[model samples]
Target: MPSHVWNGDDAPPNIHDVYDYIDRELKTLKTKLITKIEKQFFGGIEAIQFLIHIEEIFKSKHRIKRVKSLIPRISGWAELDLFTRTCYEVRRPGGGRDAGFTKDIQTFNAAFQRGIKSLTDLQDELKDLYCVVQTFCRNYQSLEGEFDLKWARETNLELKSAMRGIETLLEEAEEGVNIKLFSSDKFSLEVAETCDTKRYPVLRLFPDLFQKFHFSFHLIGKWRANDQIYLEDIQFKLIKTKRLQRLKHEEYNTLEIEHANLLSIIVEKRVRVKCREIRDRIKNLDQEITKLAGLKRSMMLEKSQTESDIQERKRHLFMNKNVTDIINSKDLDNILGVKKDIEILSKKLKSLNKSLKLNENDLVAKEKEKVALDTDYEDMRKSVSRSNQLAFERTELSKEISIINEKIQELEAIFYRKTDRNKLSQAFEDMKYPAGDDEE
Candidate 1:
């Protein structure tokens, strides 16, 4: 094999080339080792005794159980029996098994045959049984220490894993594993039948799961892409775009997530502003309504007092009519005195008529003013109602904004995981898998 040296600054060799070269080297080493052993042991020997000696040599190493067992199969009836049974099983799958299953079985059977042939081929290579045993013993002693260390280290990891599994089982026996059941309503009742009651910290449930936000503000804003959204004001003249798309392939998709979060914040800001404006307007309307009500009450009291004055004047006019009738019914001897009394009473009645007419005119004017105030008050109430509707629409926009934020977070989490996996894979691909030690 040609020696290859790796430079720190140079690019690593092709992975395929590395794999092919390793395969070639292993095959070459195995063939050369087998040839050397055969040449050193080329003589006559009984096959059964030869196989037994090889098995005995393999058995010396406790870790070599699999290879030791295979040695007997080189000349034993069990090997032929296994091959026959495998062939029979391969054909048996043809009756009702799937085509792919049958094909897989056949493939496995072929591999089994190849393995058997490879093992049995070593039988012919063992020419001089006594000489071959000595060579095997020597090779075994040379590699035994290294093999023991490698096997011990490999077994240690498996034993540790097993210990951990056993400890888990013990814990399960004492304190059972908790399995929670959840209802659609997000309400949970703990059922600790087998396990002891375990306290789990309370987690706030997602609002979207139970309550769907009204999307009445669909006209306000909407997501254009997974990471971006478009917003517009009531007049639709001011349009804003939020983007979170990645600039580079290596960059994280978190940019778009941040943009998604911004959408909610923006909506929240609008809601707060609109709410404040609505509140202020409502307060002004309430104050105006109160003033109108107070004015209407005062006007009503003034109207009642005017009506009472008119009644008093009418009563005096009636008293004067009775006095005038008495004067007319009196004798002609006191005509002059009666005339004077009549004149005074007539003047008083005339003054009362004029006052009554003035009061009636004032009442009519006040009634017209009161009607206008009532109309104004009703219009103000309608304006307040419309403002409330707008506030509700803004609230709906907020809920929808929350949902969009959650979706962005979910997408970010998924992308983050995939990005990590891709990074790890790229790192592995970039790694240099050395075939052997550096050559000078």
Candidate 2:
């Protein structure tokens, strides 16, 4: 709440204190303006004219909704002026935004809103870097379920990352910390034991620097003792231990490639971890799939056997037979295949013979029922014989059709022709008609 102590709770306390003072003064000014207008125009014919003249007192002097409303609105404008000025005091270098333009909390809340908007914009630009940090933060189980996602707070849908790169090079050659000896005095850094901090990242200088430039570059950051991750905070320190040569474009590329290689090594480590997990999952799935497959095969075999039994029951009548008389399945198959037609014919012939004998006796016996039965038996025998003859003819017809097909093919090949009886007769008549014409 002290003046000029801006940015407490990362906000400026001085801004608010100044706003409070300005607001009080504005309230006094409004009261004076209202009173001076009312008193000077009281009880006179020229009072209306006087009031109209006094209406030009403010930015918008037509009317005021309420004393509280008007004063507060005026106070807000004043506060905004203060807020903008305060931001100039502590504004970052090359910073385009001024503060009160953003954090106007008292009157219309313009300052707070615009500040939020700018910070949100910043978050958007750092999306990729934030994403990497988020992944790293998530890797440690301690931070897992308790993360504050800034992207959501800012409503930045694609703001997933932010990255801080640190580069340090020094020339002094030989102690573990002093790996380089330089000719010029400008850039240098020393290697040291790791520190514990949220944002420190560390890198060791490449050996090429020591061999060629007598300078080695090393980077450092705080690391978590438990998590083994580089600290979230990172800074670059170029120690001026000795003079060194400025780097060429190719050297810059080499430095960049080395940094890229370092990141790649970490990424590869993560990939290996992920791959191992995937392999384990695949193995488990394979086992489960194998188990399910075996179960499915078993159920299918049982289903097939049941269906076969049901079909067999429907196809044939199962007359009970003595165990000794019943044939085994293999023997039954052979008997039914080889001798079925002959057995059926023999049985039918015997039945016909018996019926014929009974029919012959029926007439001699002179019984009407017997005669009818005998006629019926004869009719049945004739039908059976006719059916057998028809079946035999069907076989003969099939053979004849096959033979005709072959003959048609042969005729086609030879271009064979046959005489039509009616046409032959007509031709003969034509020939006779010619002879008759000659005679006439």
Q: After superposing candidate 2, which stretches have Cα over 4 Å from the reference?
A: 1-269, 317-440
Candidate 1 lDDT over residue span 336-407, tens digit each:
444555565556556555655655565455555546555654544554554455456555655555554554
lDDT of 1 at 401: 56
Stretches off by above 4 angstroms in model 1 are: 1-78, 81-111, 115-330, 381-389, 392-396, 412-440
Model 1 scores worst on lDDT over the 10 consecutive residues at 201-210
| Residue 266 alpha-carbon offset, candidate 1, angstroms | 25
Using all chains and alpha carbons, the TM-scores for the candidates as numbered come to 0.26, 0.15
Q: RMSD to native for every prediction?
A: 25.5, 46.0
**Cα error, candidate 1, residue 332 (Å):** 3.3
The window of 10 residues in a row where model 2 has the poorest summed lDDT is 215-224
Candidate 1: residue 263 Cα off by (Å): 25
Number of residue pairs clashing in candidate 1, backbone atoms closer than 3 angstroms, sequence gap of 3 or more or interchain? 1
lDDT of each: 0.34, 0.32
Q: Who wins the TM-score comparison? A: 1
